[model samples]
Target: MTLLPDPAEARAARLACRQGAPRPTAGMAPGFTQCNMISLPKDWAWDFLLYAQRNPKPCPVLDVTDPGSHRTALAPKADLRTDIPLYRIWRDGVLAEETPDATAAWAEHPDLVTFLIGCSFTFETPLQQAGIEVRHIAQGCNVPMFLTDRDCRPAGRLHGKMVVSMRPIPAGRVAEAAMISGRTPAVHGAPVHIGAPEALGIADLSRPDFGDPVQIRPGEVPVFWACGVTPQAALMASKPPFAITHAPGYMFITDVPDTHWQV
Candidate 1:
């Protein structure tokens, strides 16, 4: 197994990425569980929380910030307003800007509530330990995500079809991949569906809704799992007056370990 990078080191690396430091090798921090962040006004908190609950496969709830508070308690003494390497601010369902920090924008909205969603990083450690290679990490490209035909149960004003991330696994190791990831429910536990992409309403594997596509080797099967991007899609569909989320691939590393999420 590769030695786990120090959390402080990982945090500094992310900070450097944010500050335009030369891009470090991708996937250097092997074991730490990374998270997807969402910040919204207090009025929408209850609805978004319920949305995540209704769609556990995609929106795995981890931690949340106190209304109007910038600090996140679940992670390593981090600030929700700035710890993330990059942020996306949405206005009326449209992306307004992608920036390194949201402190300035968030300052204007004193009643914002932040949510940290579980990410696939929590499960990738075990996958790699089992000798399954994560292609995107090896290729230094963002994990490919797609919008699926699967619809999540509606909650208040939050409702939308599920979005998923794809990983190609060798035919011999598909079951092992599924079993290893199925154990951790907090970070989108298990594959929601596998094998065919078209079965999930994905028309073309090469053109993903988000992120770059990886070459699926001839014998490898494309596997699909629920993705954290579901919330961003929901937020877009709902068209909330305002919202914020972590840029894809840039997640918030919490203080908790993968074992902390084990069933």
Candidate 2:
């Protein structure tokens, strides 16, 4: 497997992302934690924080930045406004534009507070170490994500259905996959569902609400994990006047080590 050490790998990835050529960060810094970032106005920060706390599985809080600031404790040298590969601008909960950086958004709305939420990619390294194949990475595409029938608890104006990322695991190794990922609650943690896509209101595995679809081969069972994308869906539901989020699969690379998330 490819190995890029923490911090250095993260810094290089951030530099590449800042170059205006945005792409998925999955498999980039293998052992570093890739984070889901959302910047909201201070007026909406408290409710969003509550939403995360109440829906910890999908919105695990990794680190939060001070209001009007782009720096986070997760990576002192990183600029949250531009380090992510892609940024989504949401106006009244509707995605307005997708860009490589949030500099313009930050400049326009200085009161935005940033939230660095945990991502499942943090645990993918250990899964790879355990000999599990991450098919999307192997296929050179973004992980498959879907909106589910499950609902996340609402915090004030924020409420929406849960979203999940799917990984096709060999039946024989499903237990091992669960064990490996279950240890990292700071990330999305374990699988929320293991077999049926239809049960989650996902009609087809090949079609996803966010990210690219990956082939689920024969003899493999589809595993679903509560995804950070849930918040974006919630933002869409709640219709916040303004917000900024990392595009699906395009996450913020942090100095935090993957091991730091292991419980």
Candidate 3:
């Protein structure tokens, strides 16, 4: 059985990550939801929100903060500026650098607004409970993510290709995996594609655009899910002046349980 930590303990682990400890959050806090955070200047909030609205599967929103505020309803006591394990700093749509925490970045852009996009990792717990083998977890690596050829509906200045994360499942259990994850729309509910990376214009399963790749065994097929990283791809395409996002696979732990978003 997988060990699941309570929310507070999970937050503490994040705090350690903030202080320079490195860890991927894929299988942590098993019953709690995880989020992908995007922090940007208030000037860019509305367009991004509209973008998220236009593409709900990959960009399902968990929470949004008021202008210049770091606090969110997702985890009242957790500091948005410091809780996520890693953050990607983007300048003019280019990756400027990666840091474990966002304190300095927040200081440079104090007027930033934060959006917490739901993550598919939040649903993996149930998949595991149902006896599905989460391949990346079993392989002990970050879930592999790819950028697709698909275009999202344009919303102001935010528009880009959809991004997806892949996991290998036994051929026979693919439907069961889909059904288990389908219940939580808030966290990217179900598999978008299965068995064909080329169908999505993804050329190679081993060379993912983000996160680490895992092996696909003889009886397993690669399954893809819409990813919150889709917004980061949008950020890259739109060339936002300044932005911050949780590095892929390193998510923000929320106070709410994963089951709260079940449909």
Best by TM-score: 2
Candidate 1 C-alpha lDDT tens digits along 163-250: 8989999999999999899999889988988888889999999999987898899889999989998998998889999999987777
Relative to the unseen true structure, what is the C-alpha lDDT of residue 213 in candidate 1, on a scale of 0 to 100?
Answer: 90
Ten contiguous residues minimizing lDDT sum, candidate 3:
1-10
Better of 2 and 3 by TM-score: 2
- The number of clashing residue pairs in model 2 is 0
> Least accurate stretch of 10 residues (summed lDDT) in model 2?
1-10
Task: Report the candidate with higher TM-score, 1 versus 2.
Answer: 2
- Candidates sorted by lDDT, descending order? 2, 3, 1
Predicted structure 3, TM vs. truth: 0.96
lDDT of candidate 3 over 140-233, digit per residue (tens): 8899999999999999988899999999999999999999999999999988998889999999999999999899899999999999999999
Q: Relative to the true structure, how large is the alpha-carbon lDDT of every model?
A: 0.83, 0.91, 0.90
Please report the candidate that would top lDDT against the real structure.
2
| Model 3 residue pairs with clashes | none
Query: Model 1 Cα displacement at 44 (Å)?
Result: 0.4
Rank by TM-score (best first): 2, 3, 1
Per-residue CA lDDT of model 2 for 1-263, tens digit only, reads: 44546477778877888895788999987788889989999999999999999999999998988889999989899999888989999999899999987898889888889999999998998999889999999999999999999999999988999999999999999999998999999899989999988999999999899999999899999999999989999988899999999999999988888998788
